[model samples]
Target: TVIRNAWAGDPYPIDTLMMYMSNMAWNSSMNTVETIAMLTDKDEAGAYKIPFIIYSDAYYSETVPFADLVLPDTTYLERHDCISLLDRPISHADGAADAIRHPVVQPDRDVRPFQSVLIELGARLGLPCFVNEDGSATYRDYADYIVNHQRTPGIGPLAGWRGKDGGSIGKGDVNPDQLQRYIDNGGFWHHDFSDDQRYYKMGNRAYLDFAVEMGFIPCAEPIVFQLYSEPIQRFRLAARGHGKVQPPDAERGRIEAYMD
Candidate 1:
């Protein structure tokens, strides 16, 4: 293994100019190759070894003597394309996104995107910067590529919290044929409660009777006004000092105190 990969463990991040990803882990590592090139372009010991050491910044920190350029990455509002996610066996809102992330405007940054960064570096080195048909370059264009190659099986969502256009995702008939029918109807339907799994709650007389008949368990009267000691709801009042104790509200509500 290379020195950087040896230390960085599995799936080591190698970068442009054959540097490790960790080499660019910090600001000081930015423009590392450029600094080395400037120094070693003529100097004796600085020759070859300088760029090599600069490249090694992924594994070793002191190797980078200086940096030359740095580009600010864009915000969520300034980017597009793809993202990676793990398998989701369980999701809230009946398999809907738990939160939303919508951008009001298109990408406004003068920045090459994550994939474009790699492609840009490769182009400078005269290496195959993601080849396209008719000898065109593919790496430089992500927005177009996403539309062309299309999204992968589970990735490539620009936003996280968009509600289903009509209903929901992954809820409906369990049978394969029925599930396909639901997908045909725009990927939505009511949940299949075929199993009839029920959580215990008061006023469920039928469930209580069934439980007793099975000699399983007896239901007890639920307590009224249960002492609900919870985390003190905390928010700052403009007039209150930092970390100061303040009443929750003036609506004659319960005063919950919890100190731990």
Candidate 2:
């Protein structure tokens, strides 16, 4: 839909699309030819009529030539990454978890991790959190941000042993050697909950409290499962000409039919 709107110049919200390790061919899992054609569409002036695509991928693929700008990225073994609860965390039914990927070998090519490029771009753009009051870059690189940028006073992306001696967990002062601690501990962290806190995690009181402390939930409270959603109701009201938040006419039918 975004590509179609952009190609048609229908006042689409996006002027540019920055994709990282995304397969445009597999997006929406259907309409591959249409998606690619719309993305590569040109105006009468021979410029891209659709959103200007900036793509990053570690390897060459079928989607590369269509991008206006292509950033070469390093393999996973050549970069640092954090899988945090704030994003798509790696966890099991027994516990909430997070992990890191530290570079084991240096890349011989002129490529960097896509994340590093994004951090550099953020600093260049002077993004609020990525820049200091004096306009200096807040972090030197992705690894620096992983170690120093606190989500709160002390907590950061990693949930492993924190603080000076690498002894604390959950919340603590930032440890300069935190990444080394993780590397020493085999490049991942796992916190297993007590047996009483395992089952019915979403609604369980004990589990909820643990989740909050580990930066999973905003607060420890029973998570009520919604059957009929309020947003669906809002969309329905908007369709009836009754609310501020209204979906476009083309989207109204789908919004009105939302069940889950």
Candidate 3:
């Protein structure tokens, strides 16, 4: 959808396309030839159809050539990373868990961590969340943000060893030494579900309650499975010209064909 949006200029034309670690020109693309064509294709004015592109990658992959700016990134062994609970968590059917990656060795080159670069970029752009009330940068780096930035009052990227003294789990106050706590615990944290919360998760009362406590769900209501999705139907209806926002003529056919 991102490629399609940039290629067609649907809704509106974009000024810049920023990508991180995505190899759309080759490995990640379903049709590499078509993807490359779309990436390099120019408009009538000789401007690229997708306009400017900024890409960050640890290695010089095939997609780097298409980018207008290439921000070199640090390798995994030289950067801090989190397999966060708020993002793609490492969870199983019986329990939920999260992990982190701490740099074992410092980089010998001049490359910086992509996450830290992005954080600096966010601050430079004066994003509301990245700036303080006095208009100063709120976080010094990615590690600073990880420890103090709360998505909600008590919830953050990690789900374990929370609170001021690092005794709480699931939800609590921000812990300044969260990264150290993760490091001390073998770079990971796991929460085991009780017997009642182990199976039939969607409709299980105990599981639902636990999910709410962990800020995974809004409430403790059983999640009802839907065979038919209304959002998908809405898009299909829009393809038939039944909405305030409709797809372009070139895209209507594709939407109708695949929306089902």
lDDT for each of the candidates?
0.35, 0.80, 0.88
lDDT of 2 by residue, 200-220 (tens): 887889888877777677899
Q: Model 2 lDDT vs. the true structure?
A: 0.80
State the lDDT at 137 in candidate 1: 63
| Stretches of candidate 3 exceeding 4 Å from the true structure | 243-250
My TM-score estimates for the predictions, one after another, are: 0.32, 0.88, 0.92
Candidate 1 residues 77-132, lDDT tens each?
Answer: 54442431222322232222212122336655464344446555555556653564
Model 3 worst lDDT window (10 residues)? 1-10
lDDT of 2 at 146: 91
Task: Between candidates 1 and 3, name the one with more favorable lDDT.
Answer: 3
lDDT of 2 at 107: 95
Better of 1 and 2 by TM-score: 2
The deviation in Å at residue 174 for candidate 3 is: 0.5
Model 2 stretches with alpha carbons more than 4 Å out: 1-15, 26-29, 43-46
* Residue 16 lDDT (model 1): 21
Candidate order (TM-score): 3, 2, 1
Model 2, C-alpha of 111: deviation from truth (Å) = 1.2
